[model samples]
Target chain A: MGFGGRCFRVQWGPSALRRFRRSGCRTVRLSTVRDSTPGQRRVPRPVDDGDVPSVVALSEGRRHNGRVANQSGGVTHMTLTAVGVDRPGIVAALAAVLEDLGCNLEDSTMSILRGHFAVLLIVAVPDTIGAETVEAALAPAAHRLDLTVAVRPLGELPSLTSNDQTGRSRTVGGAGADLGEGEVYVFSVHGADRPGIVERATRSLLEAGGNILDLSTRLVGPPDAPVYVLHLTVGFPPGSDAAGAADTVRATLGEVGVQVHAEPVEIDVL
Target chain B: MPVRPVLTLPAPVLTCRARPVGSIDDEARALAVDLIDTMKVSPGCVGLAAPQIGVGLRAFVVDVTGHRKAQSCHGTFVLFDPVVDSASDLQPAREGCMSVPDLTGDVRRASQVVVSGIDPQGVRRTLHVDAFEARAVLHEIDHLDGLVFLDRVAGPHAVFPRKVYR
Candidate 1:
């Protein structure tokens, strides 16, 4: 399988499933979106303290066991989510803690909603570091920042397509890959503020064989007839109907928008 | 010039408005060659601003030739103390930077623009460009101004993490 983004790998077995791995080039590539504050990474430094361990450790342990150790090293992946009232330096503060613990910050996203800052991070930590130790390590920063944080060892990776009815959806709902694979597109819907827009619009994209990698919405315009603007980055399987998917989504969102537009995100890696 | 290391986020130099290149001195010429060599060696890299290499100066190199999204390829070129003479037709597109490393954002940029500057040969040139070339030029210019794509993202949700599988 190509490391193209949004390419779907259909699993044939007792239970049918699909996985989303993204890459735009010849090599099998993987990319996760990191939503964080900019320029906070220390001056041109080694990305991981010269350490070379990965989530590959999880492959041998499999599910039903949260603590998996790689024979070469004891590093494994953990999922951490945090949220609290919005404030500056929260990322830097947390980044410092992770660095001190020798944890590698993997995929992540941080966004301010209303007055709250929410972050979902996947980190690789030494297997010796349990969930509680991580929570305790972050306790000081969490308290100082007035944030609520949770860390847990990841079990089996959930199928990328089962968001509607799975725990994976709750933990990392919008933490999907950026569509650099097969075909990438942006589908946006804007109109008077209302409910069910996300549910309805995202449903259509999912139905069109598109994986919703990232999604965000904003309430804009005057207080009266405020506008709700939503943008989605979608990755479709190779050679799939990208334009058709957008048309299907636009048609599905039908007039729920003052304006609805979809276009290919033709990105040149250069 | 050797391929200098790219300075990443939070590097103080990246946010500082670079000094203007008064004239293409030997140092300026070397910086141009370094920028060109660095941009050439990096895969999927189309441009590089002086600040990206930790040089607080107004210089950048861009080469959009052979890119599928490019409409007005400039081949490979460098400009010193460049300035945008005119810019219009703003559109939002996802952008990633070598300095930022781990994220991408939907940045609004002028799809068409007129830019003037001094070439490495110390000769003055004005470029009228559109489409992907315009975007690449604007991106490098922002770096010269000490601004990364994060500073120009559309809104709160326009930023995304760039996941890398090693």
Candidate 2:
């Protein structure tokens, strides 16, 4: 199928000549200054000495090496992966440690795979806290659970800027390579895990004008069964018949003894 | 003309709906010029509204085409008494406001739009735009309605800390 219709070219207007001054955008509510009531003092209030104790400061402060300070909002994001022999309280123990550090768990996904419990979390903590503090504070818990842990700050949030007036709707790639005419399509293929199963499957898709948007695969079942579960997102040519693409993909994988299931994504309006 | 101080959130005038353009005469043209001059004089600004300069009039200026990604759009316009046609689907975009300093947010808006309004010369015209142009036009239209970007933020994550966006 040929890519026809409009190529979606960009358009320009007189505003093109003017320089974009980044005037910050925000709104404010009006606050009417209320006059003080008669006989009401306007002097600053002072804290009572007895109510505020200045005698002793508690807790020792330590200089953590390689601490990246997150001074923005109170929200924090952390990705943690843990693997350990089946044992109770592994999560509880680790969670307790994080809670003690004043971290709030936002969201988490956990699964038992290959006899190991893996957990990923989006977390939040008080501002001015550093990644080092979280790692150090969680180190003891990791050791106790007998699971290795890795920690890093969350990736920067994406922002849409008007500096470029070309509102070309774009989908970004994790590998930083722009996939041509990308669209999100999900695929699942089940077959015996072999050296070239994934390679052949992806190759077939690429030849049919599809780009793999996201992919994850795993060897499943016992060694005797030797089955595999492959999950991936592929971009199809805008003009390609989506059903035909799916069928072609399935047929190509079938030749290699792989079972494939593919479907177009139904994107909800934002 | 002096660079007018941008009124921030909590400024009563920001939410106060502006009056329609009575006539696109010298004073209205002067407001447009002051807006352009004031915006240029400020550090980094893309648009300005009369309400931001303490005028409650349905007039604003925007020029996003000079910025990145917006190069394909109509760069600027002195939109007066504008109305956005809602004939297209809404798309969400991250937006910042000059009045509400230090905040940015994701705002749902029409992906394409046609704006009808009187120009400084009292001539009525309709401008068609899509995507970023639609977004910029919608943003300025909000100003005419006495609305701010903060009002469009869906949630906390929808808003971001201000960066030195030139």
Best by TM-score: 1
For candidate 2, write residues A31-92 as lDDT tens digits: 11111121122222122235222221111111112221122355466655556664455555
For model 1 the TM-score comes to 0.58
* Residue A164 Cα positional deviation in candidate 2, in Å, after optimal superposition: 27
Q: How accurate is candidate 2 locally (lDDT)?
A: 0.57
lDDT per residue for candidate 1 within A21-77, as digits (tens), equals 111111121223332231123222121212212221111211213322222456777
lDDT of 1 by residue, B59-130 (tens): 999998888778887789999999999999997778877776556677879989999999989999999989
Candidate 2, residue A40: Cα displacement in angstroms equals 22
Model 2 has a DockQ score of 0.06
Collision count of model 2: 35
RMSD of each: 14.4, 17.4
TM-score of each: 0.58, 0.40
- Candidate 2 accuracy as TM-score: 0.40
